[model samples]
Each structure stands twice: as C-alpha cells, then as structure tokens.
Target: SQKIEQNSEALNIQEGKTATLTCNYTNYSPAYLQWYRQDPGRGPVFLLLIRENEKEKRKERLKVTFDTTLKQSLFHITASQPADSATYLCALDMGSGYSTLTFGKGTMLLVSP
Candidate 1:
C-alpha cells in the first residue's frame, strides 16, 4: 500500500512572499503528481500537475516539482496573497490515465498582509 503525507500544520507567510508546500510518499510509484486547493467545507480545486519524468512544471505564479527519486513533490506559490489562503492537497496517479488516485489530507496555507 502507498501512503502520502503533507504537513498537517498551517503555514503562515507574508502576502508578498513565496509559499512552499511539501508532499512525501511511501510504497508507491506514481506516474503523475497533482496539486489542488481546497477551501473549508468545499471540494479541492485543481492547481498543477507534474509527470514523473519531469523535474518541474509551472503555471502563472504556481510551480510544482516531482522528484521520483526522492518520492517527494514540492508545490510553490510565488507572490502569495490572502486570497491564496487555503488547504492544499497532493494526489498520486498510479498510471498515465490519472483515474487511479490517492490523496493526502493536505496542508493549510495562510497568507497575511
């Protein structure tokens, strides 16, 4: 069985600073790593995805890195704002299809002015 872990504590940062979130896994080799943002009492919204063969991927002010060798993934948000505050989740897609997925409980991020 595979397990995913993300920091259970809230991460606080200044509005202008970059926020970094970590996701580590054990006992599984996934083809893709996906990041999502979830508001309290709501479903997660998709953020970014990185393939196992890729070192990093980015979109706008967001970036994601997948290091298969380390069994870890890093999610980054540059120029973070209060609106960016949310719980971020990391999910594993075992095959290329992304249909088979396992998710972590997620970490909370709070950006303050």
Candidate 2:
C-alpha cells in the first residue's frame, strides 16, 4: 500500500538556528511534492514544490528536496524564528490535474526565542 509519513513529534528549535523536518514514504510514487505551512485555526499556505525529476528546490529561507531513490523528502527552514512556528505539511500530487492531493498528518515546529 502507498503511504506518506512525517514525524508526529514536534520539533523544537531555538531562534537563529535552522530546523530540519523529514518526510518519508513507501510504495508510492508522486509526480510532485508540495510543502505547506498551517497556523492554528488557519489553512495551509503554500511553501515549496519539488518535482519528481528535480533533486532540490529553494526559495528564500526554505529548501525542499525529493529523492526517489530513498522515497523521501526533506524540508528545511534556515534561521528559524518563533513566527515560523507552525504545523508543516507535505502533500503529494500525481499531476493528474483532477486528482486530489495526498497529505501527511504534518509535524509541528516550535521556534523559541
């Protein structure tokens, strides 16, 4: 069975440091990997999208990587701040256009000052 997973444990980090989050999968192949941020009581906001053919993609202080060999993706936040604290989600889209995304349960990141 195909499935996606992210650490259910919350990641705690100090200000001015980097935070690393992991997403792993098994028995699944996705055309695109999408990362999103969701605040309390708010919907997820788009962060980064990495294609199956791409090794890595970066935007501003964030970076995302997709490794089909290992069937895993990593999401990173540099110089994390308290404002950056949120529930981070990883979703998969097969690029069928009409198909819905398969989303992970998301991991919580707490950046303390």
Candidate 3:
C-alpha cells in the first residue's frame, strides 16, 4: 500500500530562523511532489512543486528537495516569521490520469517571536 507521512507533531521555532520539514513515503512512485500551507479552517495554498527529475527547487525564501530514490522530500523556509506559522502538507501526484493529489496528514509549525 502507498503511504505518505509528515511529522505528526507540531514544530516550534524562533522567529527569523530557518525551519525544515520532512515528508516521507513508501510503496509509491510519484511524478512530482507538492507542498502546501493550510491555515486554520481553510483550504491549503500551494507553496512549491518539484518534479521527480529535479533535485532541488527554490522560490523566494522557500526551498524544496526531492529524492526519488529515497521516496522523500524536504521543505524549508528561511527567515521564517510568526506569520509563517501554519500546517504544511506534502502531496504526491501518482500520475493516475486525473487531477487528484494524495496528501499526508500535515505538520504544524509554530513560530514564536
């Protein structure tokens, strides 16, 4: 069976530091990986996407790395602030010929000043 997983616990960080999040999976090979940010009681907002062939990608203060061999992705936020606090999710596109995404449970981030 295919499985995607993120940290089940909340991560706490001080303001102005970098926060790193991990996403792991097993039993699946995806064409691309996406990371999203979800606020309370709202839908997720897309942050970054990395193709299986790409080793690393970056936008603004955000960065993502995908390792197809390990079936894992790492998400990073530099100069993180309290406003950056949110639940981050990782989704896998299984190339099922549909526009559907399989997501992990999400990992919450709490940035304190």
Candidate 4:
C-alpha cells in the first residue's frame, strides 16, 4: 500500500519570505503528483502538478518538484504574503481503473506581516 506523509504542525512565516512545504510518500509509484491550496471553509484549489518524468513545474510564484527517486515532492511559494496563508495539500493518483486521488492531510501555512 502507498502512504503519504506531511508535517502535521503548522508552518509560520513572515510576509515576503519564501514558504517551502514537503510531501513524502512510500510504497507508491505515482505517474504524477499534484499540489493544491485549501482555504478555510473552502475546497482545495489546484496549484501545480509535476509528472514523473518532469523534475519541476512552476506557475507564477508557485513551484513544485517531483523526485521519484526520493519519493518526495516539494512545493514552494516565493514572496509569500498573508493571502498565501492556507493549507497546502499533496495528492497522488491511485492508478487504478478509474481516477482515484489520494490526498495528504495537508500542511497549514501562516503568513504574518
């Protein structure tokens, strides 16, 4: 079985600093990995996706890196702000008949001024 692990504790950072979140997994061979941002009382919004063959992917101030060899993924936000404060989640496809997504508990990030 595949398992995903993330920091259960909240990450606190000051505004204008880069925030790095980690996602670690074991016993899973995922074709791709996805990152999402979830606000309080709102569903998660897609952030970035990195394929197995791709080392990294970026969008605006967001960056995601997938290292299959290490079975880990790193999600980064540059020049983070208070608006960027949210719970970040990492998801993996189950790779079965249908599209089944397995998501982590998510890491909460707090950006203060």
Give the per-residue lDDT of model 1 (tens digit) for 30-111. Answer: 9888999999899889998788889999999999988888999999999999999999999999985636779999999999
Q: Candidate 2 on 1-113: residue-level lDDT in tens?
A: 55889998999999999999999988767989999999999999999999999999999999998999999999999999899999999998888886478899999999999
Per model, state how many residue pairs clash: 0, 0, 0, 0
Record all residue pairs in model 2 with backbone atoms less than 3 Å apart, i.e. clashing: none
Candidate 3 local lDDT, residue 92: 93
CA lDDT, every model vs. true structure: 0.92, 0.92, 0.93, 0.90
Q: Whose TM-score is higher: candidate 2's or candidate 4's?
A: 2
| Candidate 1: residue 63 lDDT (0-100) | 92
User: What's each prediction's TM-score?
Assistant: 0.95, 0.96, 0.96, 0.94
Error of 1 at 79 (Å): 0.6
Please give the RMSD of candidate 4 to the true structure.
1.2
Better of 2 and 4 by lDDT: 2
Q: Give the per-residue lDDT digits (tens) of candidate 4, residues 1-113.
A: 78999888999999999999999999966887889899999999988878788999989999998898899999999999999999999999755646577999999999999
Model 1: lDDT of residue 68: 83
| Model 3: pairs clashing at backbone N, Cα or C within 3 Å | none
Which candidate, 3 or 4, has the higher lDDT? Answer: 3
Those runs of model 1 whose alpha carbons end farther than 4 Å from true positions after fitting are 96-98
TM-score of 4: 0.94
Model 4 residue 106 lDDT score: 96
